[model samples]
Target: MRRPLSLFLSAVALMMTATALAAPHPVPLSELFPNSGHARSAIIINKVLERYHYRKVKLDNAFARQVLAKYLAALDPNRAFFLARDVERFENGARRLEENLRRGELDAAFDIFRVYRMRVDERVAGALKLLDGQFDFGRAESYAFPPSSASSPSTARWAQDSAELDELWRKRVKNDFLTLRLAGKADPEIRERLQKRYEGLARRIHQFNGDDVFQTFMNAYTETLEPHTSYMSPSTSENFDISMKLSLEGIGAVLRGDNEYTVVQSTVPGGPARESGQIHAGDQIVGVAQGLDGALEDVVGWRLEDVVDKIRGPKGSVVRLQLLSKSSGSTAQTREVSLVRNEIKLEDQAAKTFVVDPLANAPGLKIGVIEIPAFYRDFAAEGAGNQDFRSTTRDVRKLVEQLVAQGVDGILIDLRANGGGSLAEATSLAGLFIDTGPVVQVKDNFGKVEVETDTDPGVAYNGPLAVLVDRDSASASEIFAAAIQDYGRGLIIGEPTFGKGTVQTLIDLNRYVPGEHNDLGRLRLTMAEFFRISGGSTQLRGVEPDIRFPGADYLTNHGERSLDNALPWTQIKPADYKRVGQVSVDRLAQQSAERIAQDVGFRMLTERSKLMRDAEAQTQVSLRETERREEDKRRERAFKELQNRFLQARGITPVDEDADQIDEDALDAQRKAIARIEVDEAARILADRILMERERQPRAVMKD
Candidate 1:
């Protein structure tokens, strides 16, 4: 939503930015202590949370230990770099971490970082030396990626001694070489790249400034209270402003640093990345290249800000990304996408409409699909007194009118990946559905609760409405969907939403400190929690659909529940609103389930989803060339068979198995065809609802 709180907090993760690389000056680890104003900032942050934060948590010794664990995890996530003894050493002094941080005593924390840095140097030197040694590809060994229990690396990369750590790095280096070899790079090229990659890793570690360290420590502290709360550096805080103003010129995707990889967290609505339809959330960017002809830069280990810099350019310039999608199970192959960089146009992102005509454009009943990429509103335009200002409510109202004029029987508001914006827009949008009622409830840190009601007495295309949401739908999206479900106005038919109900306000650190204070970064602190009008808070348990689809569990552990230290789900006094009880959800869901079980496209999607889960479960891969090749061939065969099945079912000609490249138009056509399968199913679901609801009032039925 808008910065309702003095916290700007719609987007998820804003990573810390590294300093401009002007020839790396060696920063001695000993000198990396808390800066002059950190003590005051810490004390002030404590006071703010105590006064305004929704969750009243203590910063005691137990909290101190959690902070230490989080700090170490942020620095060395894979349990790599530091030995068990090193961790134990820090664990011994973990209680002091919080006390020292509050008192601005950062010497112990800096010492822990020093040990981490020294281990990195050791590993880098050893890995570089191992590159020159002859490697046996046929060796029956595998590397455990992400250090799991899955038969890859033994002991989860946690080492007892330096020798064990050396073996871990050796396997890491081997996995690196194997990945390149599979990608078809030559031995010499692989060697050069690996050397550069390893050396650059060490250099980047040395490049960490005091601000970066402080930012990491502070985030560990804030997030310990709640996952949404965070500390942003000055450079990082700039992105928050850019995102709120929609002034970014890039691929229009929000990225987060996941270990060594830059992951696509979410794409901005109407941005090149979202519009491209190829890139998706959970896709990992391994390489970034400038333009169509630029040589690919391996960005697997690069800093997040550096990778972002590479992805962004002047509007209309081409940027190429090599993505390893989460859906490409077993065959962890990367796909390249070329997106033209541009600003997020409000008009482009406005609610759009299409008609799903089962009768192929004949004079028959149709289903109007309104795809909302995000719940957006042009605050600037509205502030200028522009009656025609862009907003979800206004655009959707117009779309509904068009649908009504076109004689559609029902409407499905497609909110599949809408990651929520604009609280006012959501409340007003809900107003468009019902004549008048309470839509949502907001409860602050204090016990005060306020109800957001739809005051307008207007209904737009309210006949047999349904909302289609996926796991990515959050905040305002959840608010609208919950309202629809609560009022018995529509069927919420997809997966449960992303539970991000707590509201955060951005506070400038300098504003808290007295004169002569340093440029302390801002804090995006959680101050309020959202409860549905019916009473349940949408903080941890996002709104569950009235009819959860077969593939509702498509994204496992990908919601608010997956976040550590998230606010607990609770209930408050329910708002006094009447339920229409128009939707027979049980009857409609039973009819929909039978049809979905037999539908070819839905069945195929379910099978592919299983394959993806199986692939993701695999943390180990054979190092032997023969076994690796065999496995790749098997995965290729499976993928090819699935593709051919989908194409054959859709009545399209399948391409040859050996075909290297497919044209963009062909790919786009395939995507549209596949998407139509799901959209068509959703229409069928809504049509079933309409037919049942027709008992109250007659409506035309959709024909096959």
Candidate 2:
């Protein structure tokens, strides 16, 4: 029964190879399990998917398998990494492991692990080819890396040979696959090539900057840290900054990593980065120098963070970057360009507004609804005293003033899916409506409370206000809603807000290290929690809307309190701020109750939502055919109900199939009408009920 020497050598060789490869060591149970981490990466990903209103898996292991499989399939769809036979090979491997697991044969798991590693090797080879062809790091490409430490030495140097580079990528790819598999996508190889193809198409369409790599790395680091502690490389960190910043200066080109070089990913229109026009995504950055006299430093093989810092400078100051254009066929040329950075303006994030007289009959009310997607702030501009820096509070203030000047009778602050932003901005925004009041409260790690108050006495516009929130509204949105409700200044309407009251501080962990290792230092820590001024914390339990409204699934991921490590909700003594004249919430509540009872459209939506929720809650999936049939029926009922509601609300006959199938423009119009009708119905119900109740009450109700 002795094995052949070659077979034994092959097994031994595989083990040696695995050891030599850069593999993540198994984390100690103490550092990785239970309280050490969220034990909820699957939950977080599912929550994000839910915001898109995805009726899929609950926060469970089964869902995790599917997500991992989907991500893998998208990563490599052509079966390029796996043998067509390997589909069955992986299944067989899984079956063996399952059988062994059932029999309590722990040692037999090695057989499956060996098979998985071989398949991973195959996948990595394919990925290496893809990276070779796709990655083109250059001057235009800006990427950053965390400084190397004794534990994680500078793995930043380029490979001696392209083949070696490919091998490194192969290791990274396999690591990525394993991490994702742990996250819950089950079908490891089936439809993988197709998913990869879809992913490639999406990247092309979006002009993605190989951000997938960074995300993968972050996920890997996070997976090691109990699924919460994450490593953000410099370039990735900058991208995060760009997303959060209300404004950014410099050339508007987006650069990404390709092999060892930083390549331009895309162009931002009208930006100093874009205006240089010589740079673009795919163009490699070779050198960067400050001002006219600064010496040029070669950037090839440098981490993107170092390159980005060289490119970023004080506003109006010049930074010269040398770029190797990838788009140029044959002889790729290097060009140097100087750019002076400036600010990104307000019109960027505000909703595209129009005067909607859709119901021609509902005139003068002129509902001024501004869809605020984010509470952004331009820190640089604010620091520079550029009062023009675009911000949520400032932009909204201007918007309200304009609406009031235009004689708008009612205003809707549409933050239906807003994820939230700057706490300062959110509190300041609340000041725009009420004369002065306490907006929100904060409790640090030590439980010391700090109350944020609005000292301003001048109200911007005091007309009828309705804030449209959903499950996606979190952090700042919750604060504003809590304040408005406390003061009785406006009605907070929509689905329950996302509960995310925790405050995180980005403390550079690299500071703890010595010398160069401290450069571009360490991690962001969740240091505190936020609370509503009324004493309740908007932590796990978000604010309940005054009037509920239906929302798409994507809105589910908005609040952070749903996240693990989110500080628990607590309370403090209420602030002594004066409330605006109290608007009777009882009448509004009664009106909403009646409207909900009478609205068939609303009923159908709730029914459909319940069905979807039930389906999503299922641990075991149904047969494809059965699932399809059920989904079709659900859609048919929803469509019919929507059509019936439209007809009833507009006083028009139901449209025939022919009219319904007209055009995209018509469909969009119908959707918008549905939203408007909901708003109108809610508004009318409030006005009528409140007026009637006032008339019914005894005279001399304290109004001057």
Candidate 3:
């Protein structure tokens, strides 16, 4: 059962809330993808496009031509593959593909795929050759391999000697070449030898292609969408599940393939592996097994996707792993760890709070700040009567009421890094602050519109407010900020946000009959775009800060609006809301600006951010690996300098030697500490401001 409002409020009040501030159109079903072949291609391409914030295209001939050009350019920007003479010819080939598929010309489409595949292979080969030329294999050190589902802890892997390992690699390379020659059907003896080599090469290539293709393709797909809807080929989906849920029974470590072996990326903090502190990043996983009695399979030559599947299993299950220590070479050690799987709520990536008093301007004013990371909802739990489940709306409502009871003079809602989540939660969450008014406007493909409003006439708290946002704050973050700002409830602070103003509805084409050959795919079409109550589309142009703050946003290629094919920013009619007494923003802006000038830590960070931007501008590959490494070192040095300055400003002593460079454990501890400090600071600042205002009007009395 849901807890009483008062009970919820009590548990939440102590949390700080320095405010950070943080869409889509619909498409016709018929005109989208005409045939099965076109449908499949559209699904793949749309997924890529949507990921990159391109939702305007409807998979028509015009859309196909434009995207194909971009896709081809991404693969070969110089147009060197087909040559300048054949550039138009290759595009003509791609453009006619959809039309040919519509006429049941599968062979023609296959031809296109064959050409595309060849070009892709060539690009991969080029990148690999470049990689080989850049780095010295002699300088490459060996690492511990994590246990796989197929391999056992007892399995002696990675060859006992370096000479043996070199021999193994030679055979592996030889087999790959043999398989490439034997791909076509001709001779039985040659085919048989080719098949053997082919299987090994295919698996290895699968591992490599899995990382590059999936990452690149999904990135491209999402870039076309509104930055949310994405295509996660089963394995990527599993990784996401593990990352979001923060639990996996298999060895409690994340793995990715490097060269040939599956390398341990990192151990999940608080997991059995992390707790044991035995397994670490840079280790390699050569084999894995289920329980002590399970058979050990050599996974060195297996696909990483297949390896991952074998490793992940039910809770309370024991999995044995063969790991090679990074510090040791071929003569490596192994460790077996049994882990129980449970829902691992990611604390660091959740809604957290800190306090800020702005004491220089507002003394003795208790201001609670809540930084909502995302619009998370436990749908299943909520349905099961678990009303206290993790959520943005419920949690924030409770925190607000609690802060009010504690006599906080103001609140700051920080939605800085919130990427966004459920739309229902966004709307409901907005209602917590405002009494009743239209929150946002949603426009469909048919030009139909829906206006969402906060029907509840009760607000949790009414006080001085500020919403702090940055380029990373997007989607639902924009919705909430737009509502708050429109209502004139608080000051919108920070840089312009990530303007992801498009919506996607995942329509399964499989729902139709099979004979239609509509392709068993999902159409992530733009459904509606979000419009702010104050008559502006948070589409391409994000919400502008009322009192701007200096940050890294202005210095680099950032924000959703700074993307390709982004929907144009527009305006809507204003909503009904009584304007509150305006805080002298001009005065506040001047004071904040002057204060930031004196902040040595912030100044150093800005300078470092500019240097990083300059480095980022040069996307060209360095001639030598050593030169690239030197460039990396320069960036690292700058980061360290800024980090040291920040630590010193916060009265923190530097611990470079003992502490891990990034210091995950220490970072969490620091966040907790900072939260306390910021909350105290916010409260003190508000209190001081109130006192100052009272002194100026010394003849006033308590009216209420």
Candidate 4:
């Protein structure tokens, strides 16, 4: 028996906010595949969304229009491919998308993709024509390279006609040439590279298959509800699973497409990239080479998956990347890094401990610092009934015992750059801090709330504690931090977290239909929302630290609030939990603020962050070579001076900006030294807290 439509409609009604619309016009497109399987998949996904999604949204005409806008934005976010007329036509077809989806009609979505492909071809051809002619580097006119999603009519006016598009492409090509020229490339080499880059873009457009279009359109559909909800194609689903396991044989870096370049999102902790310490997040890979001696393949405009294929290889193989460093901001300078491919091991992410001696003024206090890369659990081993399966909770419990046995005054759990992992691990880890209580609340599609609690009766280490988080800390990280803060068991320090409080459940589409050996894609739908023990949802606001610190420059661009379709922050009834710890947060915050004001390292960080913010705000670049060179020099000088100031404050000799390159060993030592500086600062803060507590009540200090 077929399921009823009302079930799905009811769920949709709770989540969506749109009215009905008129029937859409029929659009023409090149049909690439049979609609039988696709229609079945669509029906199955909608039914799942209706029955399981946390938010029940209405798939009305108004919702369909939003889907259209989102799809267009995903396809041509920079407004470099599609014209205003194309958008208008797409909107007309979008008016009936809800009706089409109800009947499993995907023709309009494919038609819009077809138009986008044609537009890309035309633009690439026009861009190539400009490369054949001479460009004036001395021109005073400025080119606008606006951020993606800036599609206002005023901003898009430059691409109104073929002539206007031609002029725009001319400026773009000229700018590309200027960038290479500044990097010391000869004119012929610069022209050749620019020509290849545009050709690569055209090739990627022609290589798009039906699956790519389907995935893009479906993602747009899902993202209209929330940013985290998405649909993954069969191949991509497998890749994601491998990534989660951290068992893939590759350079060990997560790569994503940003504009025309493949950018590194982060390196897996035990991966070759992180071990080498040469590759950093936000670096753009413009070229990839096979072994040491292979010719460099310019990958500036290649597809992300294709770039990944080139970077992955058998273990022990070497992969070289030509990177544009993020430290240089918009006017990025290129550098080369070589790393040997290797499998990422679980030990790389294991809880590691370090001890920081008391600060000069406050002696005799030892602080234990434990760095948790992710909230991981050995699922396979646990499922096999292994009693000693590795998990964050168990490992951290052991670490806490070791630290406490060492006679430490306090502990700090460092969670910076920890993007979160197993939810079960988060709950169990929270259990280690408090005796027994509810850890977090979960709200489902039917508005049913369930409280997950820690039933354990004993605490692991009941001493002074702090949880350090940054903008990259999310999901399970937020859960653990929120629980600790709510119970007053520890101080939440550093910047606000990533604000991802929604829970996603993956649904395999093949399970519902009867097809032999069918490989239908999967849907990762938002199934629940996470609420803190204090009744606040950690959706867009994340977990605010009790004592805040100035974050890195990238923090401005990397959080849940920065996303377009993020879920709103909301609250629920406060759960029954009692504060257990007796620490004065107001006093600690005051002490930290005073220290930060007087600390030279922190002042340099603040100045650097401000400079980055200013650079990110600028949208125009001078085409003249002299002015461009001057701008680059000024930025370089500012960064060097900042570095010198930090070094001087730390009592280390500052290296000259143009000093000879340090050996690899010395370079690695320098990186480690710089990282220790931050750890030392965190240790000092914890030490200050311990001292303050001892001053108030000397008996509070724990003795072995």
Best by TM-score: 1
Cα lDDT tens digits, model 3, 1-704, are: 11111111111111111112111122222222233444354344444343433345444576545544444443333232333334455566766654542343333333333354454444344433332322232333222232222112122232444345444333333333322222222344443433343344333433333223333333343334333444443333333333434332334455654434566644543344554444655566766777767865546545455566556655556666666544332222233444443333444335655455445555455677887766778776789998577677778887887777777777878776566667777888888877777778887656567888778788777766777776667788888887787777777777688777767655453444456543333434456778887778888777887776566354444545434555678776665656554544665566566766776655654665565355334323232334434545565566667666766777776545333355656655544443343233223333444454567675857786
Report the lDDT tens digits of candidate 1 across residue range 61-179: 88888777777877777766889899888888765666776666766667788788898898889999999987899899987777321112223546799888888788888888887
Give the Cα RMSD of candidate 3. 13.8
Clashes of each: 4, 56, 82, 8
lDDT of each: 0.76, 0.50, 0.52, 0.75
lDDT of 3 at 619: 28
Give the lDDT of residue 689 in candidate 4. 80
Name model 3 segments beyond 4 Å from true: 1-62, 73-88, 94-98, 101-109, 119-342, 346-354, 357-362, 385-390, 514-519, 552-555, 581-583, 621-630, 657-698, 701-704
Runs of candidate 2 with Cα error greater than 4 angstroms are 1-229, 233-345, 351-368, 380-384, 405-410, 518-521, 550-562, 624-664, 689-704
Index of the highest-lDDT prediction: 1
The true-versus-predicted C-alpha distance at residue 246 of model 4, in Å, is 8.8
Angstrom error at residue 442, model 3:
1.2
Per-residue C-alpha lDDT of model 4 across residues 1-704, encoded as one tens digit per residue: 00011111121221112223333232223544436667777777777877787878788988888888778777776677877677777788767789888777888888888888888888888877887888887879877874533222234442565666676777878888888888778989877887888887777776666777788888788878776667777766655555444434666666666657677766666677878877876688888998989978889767666676677776778888988766565565577778887765677789999888857646888889999998889888989999999988999999999999999989999988787888778888999989889999999878889998999899998888899887768888999999999998988888888888888777788898876375778887787899999999988888998777875433576567766667789999999999997557787767777877777677766766666566656778888888888888888788778767777666666644234574666556555665665566667777888778778784666789
| Ten-residue region with minimum lDDT total, candidate 2 | 1-10
Better TM-score candidate (1, 3): 1
Worst 10 residues of 4 by lDDT: 1-10
